[model samples]
Target chain A: MFSGLSAFPLTPMQHGVVDEVAFIRLIERLADAGVDSIGALGSTGNYAYLTREERARIAQLAEKHAGDIPVIIGISALSTRDVLALAEDAQKAGASAVLLAPMSYQPLSEEEVFGLYETVAHNLSVPLCVYDNPRTTHFEFSDELHGHIAQLPNVGSIKIPGVPAAPDAASVRIERLRTLIPSHITIGISGDPLAAIGMNAGCEAWYSVIGGLFPQTALAITRASQAGDTQQALRLSERLNPLWALFSQHGGSLRVIATAAELQGLAASPCLPLPLQGLDKKGRQNLARVLDELSLT
Target chain B: MFSGLSAFPLTPMQHGVVDEVAFIRLIERLADAGVDSIGALGSTGNYAYLTREERARIAQLAEKHAGDIPVIIGISALSTRDVLALAEDAQKAGASAVLLAPMSYQPLSEEEVFGLYETVAHNLSVPLCVYDNPRTTHFEFSDELHGHIAQLPNVGSIKIPGVPAAPDAASVRIERLRTLIPSHITIGISGDPLAAIGMNAGCEAWYSVIGGLFPQTALAITRASQAGDTQQALRLSERLNPLWALFSQHGGSLRVIATAAELQGLAASPCLPLPLQGLDKKGRQNLARVLDELSLT
Candidate 1:
């Protein structure tokens, strides 16, 4: 079973080129901090901006650095054919599993949703995880659709965002999901800075974008949660709350990942692809204040 | 100088491959019907569903069949790099111009929007048109952003959708748009079945998705509009109105184009890439009734 903290590594770029060395270092750093798994080419990783070759290269690097740790490669594309192609590449590159956010724009029917997962599962040699980040995808997978996808051979997990409710309500949803699928199908929660809240609510895994920048802080929270120390996990979450708030602004995940990499002296520039602008003056000031409070600088 | 009707032909697919013969035939048919110009791989043509090679082949086929008619290739992709590559291919395929949509899913800032068009203009050898279809793109190009893009070299036209208001209001927006840019930059309006409404409102061109399926009807409307016979144009539009309604249901443009191609016997099946299911029994029945009413079957 996949449990504990998982880090979605931010893809590094310099002068419009993928920074392989920086990426390797970032993966290694997360692995050293006891991150249970690594996610590459996710929303936080700017998967839309990377070429197919670049994506494969990053997946290979992630696998090499992760060692025994599982690597969940994000296969988010606007077209199903491209998603299947990416899934095949990720599996060949040694990824442990593939996570998919089907069709970023346009609402899809239940049949379409089922077809998407079925195609990916058929094309991929490894297990598949469903990514239900509705905020970006614009289409939510209904409970009925989820149950149908769960019956597929390779679908083993669901990555749900932690927003829209508290742990108790989230726990209820997880229970509902559990009843629909087999016990082997894990429920993973994303979007909560306080990883313990999700873990306590019966989530088998937690994926964090902030974890890439602050591995030790994230690990501490995860360890506290695993040990059933609710107070300690909450305390860590409170301490890191300001940083999370800063990163949750305009294109927050992208900005946070880039800023954090810069703080670590890894990426040469905090450049995001077109349509996602970098931090403005006020944003930079806010980030500075957060960094100072965290003693990260 | 662009006026009257424009046609965006379907990229024919046969046996899971791009059917270049059918695609060329479709374009030639449109050109013979006196279409002012031809647009390939727009939303009406399922632009996102195609591979790079497939898209390139379709563009080349359009140019080949277009002969003396201007062929404007659609360069729509999630990444700036991919879109630029498409623009370069379009130029090589003998396209007279290219149209670009903004980044998919990720909302861009005004500055980022300008940057995208600026990059395209600087690198692209052919004249570039900015396509503003907020319905599909999910983000509207601000008047300010449009102004900045128009100032860039080689930026030639603006393609605005006809919905959310009537032709008069759209014409007013274009008039205001013209003040901020060079007079050489023409404004084209898409989404109206009748060509006269947009043409009378000062738009230089009218792009019709329905035209590919009904070239004779589209030609009649175009000829009537160009000759200043508004009554005849309106009559033809009324006949075409029911067909437009059939095409506008459930996933709209993509479904419409696919269905139209199938109706014309251009392709054996209407295939949609993953996450977009084929039309249901009710949809097919509705389309059949409309086609029968219009004597298009």
Candidate 2:
């Protein structure tokens, strides 16, 4: 359940409210596409912007709609009490596992972060994934800290923030991390653009953003890499360079993916929550062209 | 209301709920201390850890108990929708002004951030304080963005993180920022240890954490700096060197300030939101000694 491609679907919002219909459709799509797991309410899902009830409902929806595939629900919050509550909600919703990022408002200390995992991990009935997405959480996990956290109860994986661009360098980075963590704890890679490279370099899982919206494309890259066809994986990834470019130009994948979803009629137009404008007309037009060229939409 | 010493009181919590009684007492103390303004729900107040209902009630409590003093309520959130809601609540609760930090879970672009302030600023009935607190918000505001946001309606101040250590450098830093915005938008300085230096260097206000708890100590420094008695201001700040040392050693001011408040009986013993441990036994002992040595208790 921790390995292979884990697709993350956006919890689409319309007029500042969670669009439940669009969200369930996204789940069924990922489940139908044969993703090994579905990562619900990740950064791409705009989980941070959601209230507890919203997150709980999204977790239940994802768990129910993902069919036989395992679901990993993101349970990150600014406070431990809240994270624990979310984790409980996820477990009760039948989530196979939960993801936690050390989301901070007051910049957290190393001790506080460790304590957060320790407290939550002990209480959790399901497996836990440490989400090390520094871009959003602004909390960098040192390899030493990862090693410590991985040893805690229920910690099944560490979703590292991608590796070096070069294949050999990426392999070396993954191998170094593998040594620190226990064998049972799967090492997954995030950063959509680097998914193919990271999986080819021995990261057991590709926790993907693009996979949520474009599962077949993401699956092709994942399967090729898993089969040791590094060249095929790289080639497929290179084909999606236009999509990656869009992700870069638009400040990460949420807006671009939501834009793609909106354009594809997968979700409502203007799906993003407030304070987060999806894209301007020009960027959306550019995305439309790129999606057309790639045959993604 | 945007200038001089703005004392930021902790919205003290007890067993995961807002300690309204303790919170009210803290506000009344600040009012009695004769602070120029009360900055409720600031980082020191653990505003991000609270619910909208809790924050609204706190804002109302602060406004009502603060007597004639102006109360600046912090209304920052992950989404603009929530921010707008909180802003409306503050206005309804009779807030003199509102403080906003570009809080994020998705790492935002400069354009997105500017759009946030632009959207929130225009909707605000009360004047807005641009909370440039990179340490907490993890979103650094460039001077150009500050200048741009300052031009928006209701933007009355920019609460900068801090200035350079040296007197000459601090003045240069503040002066450069001064040129970026209109004179009506006062430049307030945070980073409690540097309050004296930044205020003396030309900051119109000290958005102080320590001021919330120990009003007399903070006010003396603020008054001296405003009176051009830089030597006296610096001397008073230097006397609190032990306190500053604790802040540096403990990551930042929130934890240390919370610990101080807990020891002083200003709030509950474990005042802060969970996942944020105030201090360990040894650390608290050290804090107690420093508080006693400084005659702060």
Name the best candidate (by TM-score).
2
C-alpha displacement of B295 in model 2, angstroms? 1.8
Per-residue lDDT for A1-297 in model 1, tens only? 256777888888876778888889889888887788888888888897777888889888999988788999988787777887788789888889888987654467677777778877887778888888776676777777788888898888888877334767767877887888878888887885646677777787878787776777777877887888877877878787787777566555677667656755877665566555667777766776778778641
Docking model 2 quality class = medium
The TM-score between candidate 1 and the true structure equals 0.93
- Model 1 reproduced share of reference interface contacts: 0.62
At residue B268, candidate 1 shows an lDDT of 57
User: TM-score per candidate, in order?
Assistant: 0.93, 0.96
Give each prediction's DockQ, rounded to 2 decimals: 0.57, 0.76
> Candidate 1: what lDDT?
0.75
- The model with the greatest lDDT is 2
Error of 2 at A79 (Å): 0.4
Q: For residues B1-297, what per-residue lDDT tens digits would candidate 1 score against the true structure?
A: 245567877776665567777777788888777777888888767677787888898888888888788988998887777888898888999999888888466566677777788888899888888898876776688777888888899988888776324666756766787788788888777875535576666677777776765667777877876787767776777777776676565655567656656765776575555566556777767776777777751
